[model samples]
Target: MRLSICAVAATLFTSTIAAPTSKFDSLANTSEESESEIVRRDGGDGKYFHEPGGDNTLGHYDKRYFHGVVSDEERRDTQKHMVRAYLDFFRKNDLDTWIAHGTLLGWWWNGQRLPWDFDLDTQVSGATLHHLGEAYNQTNHSYTSDDEQVKRTYLLDVNPWIWQRERGDGMNIIDARWIDVRNGLFIDITGLSETHPDSQPGIWSCKNYHRYRTDELYPMRETMFEGVIAKVPYSYDKILTDEYKESALVNTQFNGHEWNPNAKIWEKTEETLRQEEEERKKKEEEEKKKTVEQAQMA
Candidate 1:
């Protein structure tokens, strides 16, 4: 009887499985579109996407899939789940990946994302990037909450321009993204490649123009990030210091928030709140002035 039940369960699971869609196969053509065309064609609303004059190489941000911005408390809750799911998926697939940039800095401070941050950053080797683009791009992964009350789907979208690897045209720096289809939040995944394998074998570079020596990255260390096991560069301290400068490691006050050692969270400073209130009022006044001018012109 037990064997019969096991067979039935396995059959049921197999019956319910469905194939993934190739939603991102056409992304290759958009590789060189002007900034305006990119947002229009990609369904990005410009809220979280790259600005016209801003860094164009950053990964694509899709507003159509976004669930709109929520309060800070709610945003953090969603992010916590997003990151854990991301790490688990990569590990189970046996793909080599590690945290990078601000995400790495967050792991250094609290083994998680910084409270103020809205996205995550991760990286893969050149081989891994190609494999993912070919096999997993445009795939959707479904995850259910612990209580089974909420289910969110994530999309792994690969950049078609992964082949143009020479930091060319300063666009498409980010190689791919693991995106939360429900909220538009995502982890930017870049690929690291040999800058000059023939001459500078030890040197590597990302499309973003950041360069690193092998000793700074190799032999990745295992660590906890956002409550899941994750990998980080070996010389994390030096990497952070090199990118953000030494003061970033020691500074307690930043971006109108202060670190609370006991609570292990960044709290909004009183001054920051006051400044925000003033800014809100100023914006209101400016809007009112614009309304009056428009009325007079009409």
Candidate 2:
């Protein structure tokens, strides 16, 4: 079912961590919260219902949320907070993590975000995810922006499902998310499980997801991404190629932006690069002709 942006936004905003109390209240207030409604709808039976929102009534299918029309300014602001939360988690736990997939593609060329990207993707080991779930569930992080008035609070969403890997469903390893509730932008954290057949020591086993050795992914590299401290995989090229073919590195058009074979965005940057190359070639030819004339005189 399709969820509307407003409904999704409302659900996310209200699903905050419950205030801690020394004693559990047997009769916890059960006022029908937006999040609970959303959860019920998602987990509900086949019967669909309509929800009232002013003159228009939104249906169950209409409420499913995907990528919405987020402004560029809003995206940039949201990305900054998401990156900060990721870095904070890594630093606190000493876990090695790096940007992957489309996020890495953005970092590769511009050292910035893909203006059209809806979310961020990062990779961690199975062990790392396990560590985070146990130690960092529902942690709060705060970052002060360059402007003193803009203080952002972020929540760490480490799903408890990371430890349930015995079922053989590989895709379930996606373990955590650093969600920006205000903007609906999130960072998806996936665990790269070890895959091996014999269960031998130093041999990893990944039943559903792709397998890689610790040595292959170790020695994380430091890189600047979206104007923040970021980590990248050691063999980033291999990872990219495995996920997306070599063409993806060169393909410019994706999401909303047009892929320019010659330029970065296909609109302006390619033209600039082409002009620069043409000018360089013309200068080289002129220099060559001058050298030939000088040689003939000698």
Candidate 3:
């Protein structure tokens, strides 16, 4: 049940774009192709340049992932299912995963999925990634949906460049992913390894140039996230504060979206979706008009 990314992307490009209530919203707010030299390279940053939200990948630093429009409700539901699916898969195989970065932030906030998050983040030991790359790369693990009628397929795709211990992996530093085979939404899994044998004993770094001391992350704390058992860094509070600053832990209204205590969901205070729709329509109209003019000249 394993398939190449190109095969999946080509198929999805022809499929109906997901609705506004679906589980994917291409991160429209990111500054695509920033001046960061770490990203302006020959092969670009991410390996798979997906068509918008057609894939679960972030398409980092490029305007790569730009399709699919899912609502808040659909987004949360999908997040839950996706995380649960990964939990089940990892437990069965004895692969350890812990919530990191934004996923950890979500756990700190409410032990639930962040409404603003479009993807999930976790980390595994370097050995775990190597085991996956060897044994399960691109292998499909299928599970029945929550309804128990239809089936869902997941792929554990590992990157070949996981051995590059240097800090300049660009977007490729993401050593592996657990992808939802249906629509390509995936959770980014990074490998945390020692700096080098000769270097300091506790030095650690990720592909994204994120360096950390070993104690900052060792001894993963098992906890519940989105109703499923999960793991987080030992120093989750310190990690969250260090990465996101103090406001992220306390601020409820940073993004255009706000966390509603009554509904227990993050809701946008403004018509951001409506505005984006108008922008999309305008872009389409402009393209159509250009096509009409070209036809007259031809």
Candidate 4:
């Protein structure tokens, strides 16, 4: 009797979220209230359903909610929403979080989302995870944006497999996620815990098998991400260089892109890059033909 009632409720819930003509209409037409239906459609919390054992990978989410391929604008909105919602929650609860990985790299160049990046990363302490588990796990956060006049729902879901410290499976590395319930956009959160492996006495490790020094992450620096103030590693320079490379910090042209200081973003039209490549190839071909002709005449 209870299952039937829940099923009927879920059906009704999904009906209400049908995408509207508005620009801000959710790319994925459902929210957390209808999550049970989503789970039922797929055996697990869906993310990367194509990859074997992807259901187990922490932070790699499936975009099954999207009816078709996601648009760039939708990707941009999803990223902004993910960060804005996350920062709001942390600020409200007095929880400390630091931007890490690609998200931090993006902040270094400009206070904008990296055009090609969708996955976001953040970190907190082990104690913080437990605190969240006890008080806020499986919690749904609803936020209202006056500008867009849209209410968005987010979910904080933690992985119970984190208790097993062995770090054997690649599938279960993500400690938790702050998920955009409507679109499946999420910020992957990992808890750094103190570990005493044979190599060192005081080493901080995460379930993902990453080890760091105790002092490395401490004294988090205040910085802005996606236009909002947030925390970053104290030794950002060192961390960024280690993860990416020294040239990555200085290179303006990457992936056929150039920085536009006025816009404060990477901007290069596909046609422009294509033309440049073609011109270069044409010049190379001319030089090669001239060299061969000269050699044969000699």
User: Each candidate's lDDT (Cα)?
Assistant: 0.70, 0.55, 0.64, 0.64
lDDT of 3: 0.64
Q: How high is each candidate's TM-score?
A: 0.73, 0.59, 0.69, 0.68
Q: Where in model 2 is the C-alpha error above 4 Å?
A: 1-69, 147-149, 166-173, 195-208, 256-298
Clashes of each: 0, 18, 12, 4
Error of 1 at 290 (Å): 16
Cα displacement (Å) at residue 33, model 3? 31
**Candidate 2, lDDT over the whole model:** 0.55
lDDT of candidate 2 over 162-232, digit per residue (tens): 44443333433446777665544567777655333236333332324555444445556665666556676
- Positional deviation of residue 279's Cα in model 2 after best superposition, in angstroms: 40
**Ranking of all candidate structures by their TM-score, best first:** 1, 3, 4, 2
**Best candidate (score: lDDT):** 1
lDDT of 3 by residue, 32-128 (tens): 3343432344245445323343344344112322245555566566667878888878877877777888887777766766677778888877667
Query: After superposing candidate 3, which stretches have Cα over 4 Å from the reference?
Result: 1-75, 145-150, 169-171, 270-298
User: Candidate 4 overall Cα lDDT vs. reference?
Assistant: 0.64
| Model 4 residue 42 distance off true place after TM-score fit, in angstroms | 11
- Estimate the TM-score for candidate 1: 0.73
* Cα-based lDDT at residue 172, candidate 3: 62
